[model samples]
Target: MTFEYAPAPESARVDIAPSYGLFIDGEFREASDGTAFPTVSPASEEVLADVARAGAEDVDAAVRAARAAFGPWSALPGTERAKYLFRIARLVQERSRELAVLETMDNGKPIRESRDTDLPQVAAHFFYYAGWADKLRHAGFGPDPRPVGVAGQVIPWNFPLLMLAWKVAPALAAGNTVVLKPAETTPLSALFFADICRQAQLPPGVVNIVTGDGRTGAELVAHPGIDKVAFTGSTEVGREIARTVAGTGKRLTLELGGKAANIVFDDAPLDQAVEGIVNGIFFNQGHVCCAGSRLLVQESVQEELLDALKRRMSTLRVGDPLDKNTDVGAINSAEQLARIRALAEAGEAEGAERWAPECELPSSGYWFAPTLFTGVTQAHRIAREEIFGPVLSVLTFRTPEEAVAKANNSPYGLSAGIWTEKGSRILWAASRLRAGVVWANTFNRFDPASPFGGYKESGYGREGGRHGLEAYLAGPDDRPGERHGEEEDGRAS
Candidate 1:
């Protein structure tokens, strides 16, 4: 069946504002060259609106404006900064539905996820960090912490608005100004977010949105005025960014790629483990950065778990993102769909048995049938690479030590899931795993009050909780405008 993008208002859901232009210095304006790109609805491959394609000149101007705002914004008392974040959070909550519709339209995530998970988490992010604004001292900082100036934030297409919250909220609450360039693929919701900021009466230039692809992101990163760069993207790009800003005094925090493992011990509750394993790999079509794409099951329960997983996968609904019953949604873009298809082909070519749920995919829009591969080994490309799609690699192991070895084998160690009945084993796994977050008996659970980031090549720095504030602040006795978050430890409960 061909896909259609039924307007949110036509369905009596909500009305979304058409978003365009480069938001800079608190003004929504056209790109420097007046060039525009059509933003596509992933559900229908239809043009949603003409979006600004920020040129290098626009990026420079945005960075300058952010730098200018940084002095005053950074000097504002933490209490005042906290209030601004509070105001923005309230505004986001007020316009949640509109934003949710736009998010689903652009990102191809089900309306359920965009509304229930993404929007709520985005707001709660601000709410969580807003309270931390005046409590920096208790956050292990000095009595008064200074803000880093002019943060250059480049967020990924996956979870665009939530990434905005991850990047913008703590920066604002810690008294820093930002020049944010969202992923070119899913720029709509963030543009709408700029409008909400205007309504919140946030100081002009405190937060700016420059829309463009990786080229625009490069410009923002290389801009001389930017004091720091925070990025959430692929590991390849993160490496390049690290190299580009190597010699500069600029600070960098990267949340990069992942090929996380979901380990199922023989003693685990089979029913719960099966459910957790399914959700870990297939939720959001497996677009999550911390997706448990690698399944390591103990040999004792491997066959039983595999049968349960196939049944669970068959129940997922793959259809219109707006449908109330939809569980899996469209692939975000044709390019992403192609990537997923290509990787799945590779998995088969490399000697894995590929299996996709028996479901029809819409023809016109980008879509991939949920896929899984059994008989996978560490040598399989599917097991080693971050497919970033609804593809799971199944592997079996014998002991806890072997499971840990397999889980940590990936160069990417972002997050891991452990399913076990023994509390001691759970604690041992959590402690031994190099991942930033460990879920025991649960998978893919997120709370705004939690600090999230990865270890090693998966990237550095945290994005939530009190730990997030450290990335944006300086101790009171530090040098003028110097960053003091280098010593910030991750101790979030």
Candidate 2:
């Protein structure tokens, strides 16, 4: 008999205000248009709070505020700036439990993940960048690097607070002021972070949070005052942002979607490989941009691997996001749930064999069972598309060369994984994998010190470590003692 664990829910310890407003210039104020929208809990369909919607005018105000704060902020000694980041990091750690519970409620991710992975990484990212703040000269980005003025950043809902840290920490470390927009579905943590800024006593306008939909993001990115733009979301939106900033000469970075391949060699340790596959695809309800949705197994061991994977998948607990024992949680929103359902339906229509464990879903909120598909081919929609859900497509490959070819066939180059005990073979396979981040014996691992990004359509511009600092700084040509005259078309010489 299977042991059913009793429900252990985390208490809602955070004090969320009934209404939230746009955080601009270190102050929380209502949108100029007085428009507000409700943010709901995906696990219970409960309305959490009313968030002010930032319109174009609000975006402009945020940009202006960031622009005004840039000079004094950039002029501060890097060590002084580092102190603020360190303080923020400490504050994050101090209030991690509150943030974790808030994130779980806001994002519909398992409480275990919000507490263990999300919150810790959020704090660590700030801590990692804090050290780099005072050491820019030795960071290999030329001598005495200068901050780019105001930056506009847009983050998605899948990993809200963590993504905020990924974008905001490095930008501040490099002495650039920022105007940030959290996804409409998950805006509370960003607002809470604004409070952290107040607690840290950070200078006004160093970090600003705007809450709204795509229109708000569009205005923020296209604002003439923004010196840089960083986005993390769908490939389609990333392309639009790229186009919007093309002729404006704004520095842009995008960390977009992926349909990563988790390749299992015949000689791999079966038990560990199955665990890796589960963690790779199902973590955060598979809302991750670098989720390993495609499983490429050697033909010789395909049946064995699939059997093990299915058995393991059957044990996953899917339920309340606040439950500490829940392995998978609710879909982020109704719209996202509909998209996942459509893509999953396409997988079945294309003749892939769909299989799912018999598990009960909460009736009221958005929920999708962990699913897997067999008899999948590279041409199958399930194999080719990014179904940002808890779904896996299993495809077979005969040799390492074929495995490499099949894995690299997708438009995304974000992440990939290989499971094998052979050192030489692992190195060879990793060398040929087109992904930005490759894991030989593990999957879905992240660190603040490692630079992460993608090639091709998955987007570009590395984030994290010393490389991330470059995204917020001016190039050598624009720095003091390195200013070259402008060309005929106003391009830097």
Supply every candidate's count of residue pairs whose N, Cα or C atoms clash at under 3 angstroms.
0, 0
TM-score against native, each model: 0.94, 0.97
Model 1 clash pairs are none
Worst lDDT 10-window in candidate 1: 484-493
Residue-by-residue lDDT tens digits, candidate 2, 1-493: 6888999989758888999999999899999999999999999999999999999889988877777777778778989999999999999999999999999898999999999999999999999999999999889998878887678999999999999999999999998889999999999999999999999999888899999999999999988878889999999999999999998878899999998999999999999999999999999999998999999999999888888998999999999988889999999999999999999999999999999999999998899999999988889988888999999999999999999999999999999999998999999999999999999889988899999999888999999878888888876567411222323321223
Flag regions of model 2 displaced more than 4 Å. Answer: 479-493
lDDT of 1 by residue, 26-79 (tens): 999999899888889888998888888999999988876776677677667888
Model 1 global lDDT (CA atoms, 0 to 1): 0.86
